[model samples]
Target chain A: MAEATTRERILGAADRLFGSHGFRGTSLRALTREAGVNLAAVHYHFGSKHELLVATLSRHIDAINAARIAQLDALEAAHPNGDIPPLDLLNALVRPAFAFRHASPENAEVVQRLSALLHSEPLEIVHPLMEGLFSRVMQRFAAALERALPDLEPEEVYLRIQITIGAMVSALAGRHPPDLADAPGLDEEERIDHLVHFLAAGFSAKPLNGADS
Target chain B: MAEATTRERILGAADRLFGSHGFRGTSLRALTREAGVNLAAVHYHFGSKHELLVATLSRHIDAINAARIAQLDALEAAHPNGDIPPLDLLNALVRPAFAFRHASPENAEVVQRLSALLHSEPLEIVHPLMEGLFSRVMQRFAAALERALPDLEPEEVYLRIQITIGAMVSALAGRHPPDLADAPGLDEEERIDHLVHFLAAGFSAKPLNGADS
Candidate 1:
């Protein structure tokens, strides 16, 4: 077998430890042992467990957020005058993370396992890694939301954004969802497609005064 | 001073430990110590550590799910068309849980903490309690989704439902969110209303082909 590269080995070990034991629960010894490298190797490469996790996750978060930003940008560029529905922004948010079933299942698993790890026994060091990553992207979404509904307060928009991200993360993190009765064959792309469309429609609907007209 | 009730004490202790440590991480010794009760009293009241956690969660889950069924039924009774908008269904799913906020902020904490706990840990006992509960409710949602967007399959409905729930739970769990942002006055009901409206719209939107599209 081709020998694993140094960074690959570290990432693989970190992924295993972080996924199973969480951010705070994982130890360097466990991480080193899992990586099958010398004890000093981690210290030499990453310096600390927290740094290793941040490095490990930086790529994934960056990729997702970058894709999300790009997606939103394209949608707005394509739709002049901001006519693009706000649900389009929501679609941009989720499809980038989950659309991985086509090219790489491993990528999808990393996002999934990380979602589980983030909410589960999170290491004390996770927040700094996520700093400004989502909010930067959320600004674009909030802008789109403001245009789409045109009725909600700024404070309401912020709360909605927070709750919206939470729901997306939860959906991504959920595993044993209720099985559909007599479901159709769904490739990875199709599943992601369904998610984006459904959420877009669901989110694009106009707000009401607690009653349907 | 009035004596604390055994059941009450057990529930309280279990909530704290389980919230902090999670299902597998929590133990009977920690629970009894926190409860200021003997092991015999714990065993007499709840039988096992797992049972204590279950008993603690039972009241909240029961309240939430019961409210869920009632809200859904009311929606059905009012709409009766089996065609409630996806956002409306999303609203029905979450608003009832918010009812707990009025009873006690602590109850809201328990519910939110448990959501985060479920994200990280699995209490096998919970499956038995939650299985039939969500499966049936999901079927109702599936029925509604079919009427709204017949283009998607039931499995698609199920996956979207998972995503929707994840977002809602993560928002409420408030475990790993943008806490540093300027949070608004956002009264209890307004937050719930915002969550329902945003999620409903997001989930209701049409599927996208790709981020590029």
Candidate 2:
């Protein structure tokens, strides 16, 4: 229990530091100090700065993925008629992320930092960090999808889902932004609701004029 | 003529430096030196590093947006009867970037660097740099999209398009670990073809379960 708390403290520091300074800019010493822990404690908990990042991301990201997968699976089971309901599925897929992102309503800063780290171009260091975690979550949804739309090629479903994810990611990850100044109607709750609804429709619908085609 | 050339040269230098190093990481001295010009030339051209980012992104990003608009216009004009085929549209959107990204095939580093900058998380100095340029471009596309999908609500279309862009941006920006390894056929040409088809179908489709209900 105490170890878990130490892990949390280290993550809190890492998230703040990583977000404030890009990955390269943050240091282990700073993270330890911020966490109010010693070097020995950090090393004991996470080994190296690299290990710390993996652990930090894994701590929350894993749970978020689980939530996404579980929500998706539940949605499918609830609507098990071979006909998928897109909105519910999409919402289930995305909610965990946005919720995790804005967990502390009072402080959106940490989320923003995470957003920056996320939006920046892919890097070698972080790829493996998230690959095993997100890909599995992604694949579970893909499998459920395959069961639903058996006719569709895996590639087709994959691409379609990926595009949907891309859009949702950007919408939620607006850390460096136009300040949401123009987006008037969608409050936080509304944003989630709208995003879920929009994505569901977009994914649920057959291709444009698909019914006719 | 000389002034314009000098301005372009400065932008080129800034793009290379900023793309590789990021906003906080890059320095004006390096920029001026790379431009092979003195501090006066740098100031005369952009006034500051902040403005330099604005100008460089504006210069390149504008070209990209213009290419996208032109390409889309051409394709839609060619295909008046049916839905503006999604794959074709996806191509129109992504090819310019693909070409620009790979234009200097020998210097993969250039592409790597620029990609990093665009996906960048939160650099206080850089966020405002490209705002004016981004908003102007976004408004243009928004207006164009309004014309293309008049049947959809303005907000719905915007939200959908944002999602599509997010996926496309993520893939192109390569900000995170993508499923390309599993997506075996995603060679340069094949990737473009797939994205176009996938996104075209995506944007063209109706909302799942139909929001009207």
Candidate 3:
């Protein structure tokens, strides 16, 4: 129990520091200081700074991905004939992340910071970290979406999925320009509904005439 | 004439280096070297790195923003009764950036890189640079969208516009996973049409039932 507590402490510290300072900006020394543990504890729990980052991110992302997959599974089972609506699939794709954020207010900030860092960080850093994180989940959702939208080509489904991910990421990051004085302050549920409605409509849009180049 | 050439060269170099190396990663020395100009030349022209970035971004963005506003003006004039369709408004909001990209292949990479940088960079760096850049254009589009879609509230229009911008930025970045081997390679024109169609449908989507929370 004591050993487990130390590991949790290190991870907790890693989460806060990494979110605030970014991967390259945060030092192990600062991490140890924040966790109130020495270098040995960190080394024992996580092998390196890179490993620590993976661990920190996985703590939340793993849960979110699992929740997404489970939602998809339930949706698929509910429609064994593979006749799920696009909106349901979109909700499966989007709502878990929002739920994760709303589960704790601090999670919102940490997730946003980490996401911003991933997007802004160099390719070398972001590529490896993000490689497997979303691929499996994305592939699953892409297949489901393609099935749901029969008229749309598979490639089109994938393209829209990528664009949807961008929208979700941007919304999650919540980094609106301060000058948009009256930016709506919707609670989590409203934001999720708006996103789902917007994306569902986008996904359902017909292929443009002569859109092929 | 010579001074104008020097200024253009520096801006060009800044675009490339900043796109590839990011704001913090690119050094003044590297920029000057790439520009084939001396330190004194950069100092005399832009005065500081921050200003240099603003100037570099503005070179292309100013044109794009102006083009967007001009397109909006034309659309508004065409529909003197304020009955412009949502699709036309979306085309106005999105096409200029695509036009800017299609004008030159190099502009695509620079714009994508700078956009990625702006989204990922720390708030302190991103905030002031982005403050006035998109405010007017966003507000203009938001108001037009509100007018076009009178059924939706103003806040909803603003929210969808922000989400649309997210999709646009993500598409422009073109940083898909290398593993997604079959990712469709759409040309600039086709991509623009598809995006405009998607966003038009999204903007036109009715407010969700009981979405207000």
Candidate 4:
């Protein structure tokens, strides 16, 4: 109900501009104008465009990861022996992301666009950012997934997790194939349900054989 | 090998520049410099930067789709009754894209980078482009997938196909979770195998129940 602070305003502006124009294409002047803040204010707050991007992304990613970890903690505590179902583990990893939709609709759109943009950025920018921000949580989930799918090799577990992330990112970006006349307009809950179902099935698939027929 | 024509050289440059810098970020002057050609040559060959991008992407996508359709035709013909195994239909959908890897590793990298960049481009750019270039092939595969999975609803098939595409595009871009100390470095064939196996399982997953516990 209260007005957003200078930093929050700047981050929100950055999300919209960077989401639309990309990190490289977006200019500081434009960013400042969008935020209705001056260059001096931006410098005092975020120091550089790069740092601003980091902050803007961190605001969302940190919250999502925290929610993921909290869910994982509760799920693990309930099991005690770490025998969580793959479906529940996957839901923990995925639901937090889809939960972003429950935020104001405009905010959800900005975050999803920004997330998709991050994936398409050059490897130099994205790789280090992901490694720095996501390594801990990603590794935690990988270990949990490995525990849940004991029959699968660790490498296989990691590969499926990567593919699952891809599906999640794609769905978040709403990157469906072009132009289906009767494409079902699924609600947020249905989207999450379908994604989790697909991923859980993938994670449970039998290990590949060279002569798989 | 024969020398590449002036147009070929310009198309090649467009792919690399567009792939790395993005469509909006890459300038005509920069593209000319990269191709070792003058601005006139690019204009003469492709009319505008937009058309140049279309030509560059079309060179690869057209071939990949042709391969996909060819494989699909063979699979369907062999099945005769439209009872083709989902895995084979999936293979038809996926294998052609991965085959790009065999066309010299450098060219393969360029195509993959460009494809990833395309996904990140603004919807106005990507949407029309995809519809114009890919709609037919996408619909064809969707119908085949629907036939292959009789138990699933058409919307469910489309959603899974979209998710499969997300997974495939992510894999093509070589997007992975960062910092797995011994993350298995899957070679090309192995990567395709793992992907097909995962997708087949996902496509064949039982339809979701509301109270899936």
Best by TM-score: 4
- Arranged by lDDT, best first: 4, 3, 1, 2
What is the lDDT, from 0 to 100, of the residue B7 in candidate 1? 71
lDDT of 4 by residue, B1-213 (tens): 136888888887877777667665688999888888898998898887768877887888889899999999999889988989999988998888888657645556555555455555666787778787788888998888888788877777888888998898878778556856566566667878898999999989998756432
Cα lDDT of all candidates, in order?
0.64, 0.61, 0.77, 0.79
Best by lDDT: 4
Grade the docking of candidate 1. Answer: acceptable
Note the residue pairs that clash in candidate 3: none
**Higher TM-score: candidate 1 or 2?**
1
Residue A112 in model 2: shift from native, Å? 5.0
Candidate 2, position A77, lDDT: 76
Candidate 2's fnat?
0.29
Give lDDT tens digits, candidate 3, residues A1-213: 335588898888877777666566678898898887898877787887767877777889889999999999999999999989999999998999988988866555566655555555567777766767878888888888888888887667777887788788778877453345566566667877898899999999986657344
Winning model by DockQ: 4
The ten-residue window of minimal lDDT in model 1 chain B covers B117-126
Q: Compared with the true structure, what per-residue lDDT tens digits does model 2 show for residues A121-174?
A: 335544665566678787777777766666666665676677666666667655
TM match of model 4 to true structure: 0.89
For model 4, what is the alpha-carbon lDDT of residue B186?
68
- Candidate 3 ranges with C-alpha deviation above 4 Å: A1-10, A21-29, A36-55, A121-129, A175-179, A209-213, B1-9, B37-51, B119-125, B175-181, B209-213
Model 2 is docked with a DockQ of 0.29
The worst-scoring run of ten residues by lDDT in candidate 1 chain A lies at A117-126
How close to the true structure is residue A161 of candidate 3, measured as C-alpha lDDT?
Answer: 83
In order of appearance, the predictions have TM-scores of: 0.73, 0.72, 0.86, 0.89
CAPRI verdict (incorrect, acceptable, medium, high) for model 2: acceptable
- Point out the higher-scoring one by TM-score: 1 or 4: 4
